[model samples]
Target: MDIEKYIRNIADFPKQGIQFKDITPLLANKDASAQCLENLLQLVGGQKIDKVVGIESRGFFFGTLLAQKLNAGFIPIRKPGKLPYTTLKESYQLEYGMDALEIHEDAIKKGDRVLLHDDVLATGGTASAACSLIEKLGGEIVQCNFLIELKGLNGIQKLKKHIVNSLLQY
Candidate 1:
């Protein structure tokens, strides 16, 4: 399924000179979404994933599905103060400034294998911060997965230490 056709490009979304790849079209179509999930699972292969760490709102969409399909726990990495329990935080630099992400302190156990998921890989700041939080909780990052990747941004650079996979690249 040419997933790219299901993705809509919006100009200057959330900022100027930025083209946002919107996945709503893909998400709305059952066939496309299923194909994407299947592809993601293929990328994961048969590796053991103890937990699937999803970054923020968009990540939740496919992250939870991946967790269910893998029979792994679903952990949410959100903005500061978004989590109710004791949380750990990690901050990273964005193109314009900085932002922080937090996860529950007990979200992962020592030696747990984790798969990180997100909607897009732009600057790598958010995903990198999530990785830090997971490592701080003693969760070993198994792989970083994304629905779309802007290769021009070189977001994968910050995630060089771990395996990174994505369904689409632009």
Candidate 2:
């Protein structure tokens, strides 16, 4: 549906030389938002997703909705200490700095099939870290899905072992 048109491009955002893709426009439009969700749902039509693990913040929106659409449980991977229960954490390096992410220790049960959902795929650090956390909790990553993918960043290259689907690429 060419969802890119619905995303506003803000130049030099958050810092100089950075172009931010904002989804606020899409969020405000009912048809566009519904179409985006429909497209994402179609991508995993038959996969048995036992749960949908969303990366923190932005991912929460799409993850929770997708989980409901798929009738799967929603699991969230958050910043350290953000989760109220015992957690499993993974730290990784990024171009700017190093950060960590955590998932509840018991978020995933043994042999659970998970479909990880996030708003964007950039550099793949966060997604990769989340994938590790899911595996640590004994979940099989059935697939990873996103609304947008920054292709220039080559984020998918870092996530080599699982299937990845993105509705729009930039």
Q: What is the TM-score of each candidate against the true structure?
A: 0.97, 0.95
Cα lDDT of model 2 by residue, 56-154, tens digit: 888898789999998999999999999999989899765446899999898999999999998888889999999999998899999999989999989
Q: Scored by CA lDDT, what does every candidate get?
A: 0.94, 0.89
For candidate 2, the per-residue lDDT at 74 reads 98
- Score residue 73 of candidate 1 by CA lDDT: 96
Off by over 4 Å in 2: none
User: For model 1, how does the per-residue alpha-carbon lDDT over 1-170 read when each residue is reduced to its tens digit?
Assistant: 88789999999887788898899999999999999999999999999999999998999999999999999999999999889999988989976578899999999999999999999999999999999999988999999999999999999999999999999999
Under the 3 Å rule for N, CA and C atoms, how many clashes does model 1 have?
0
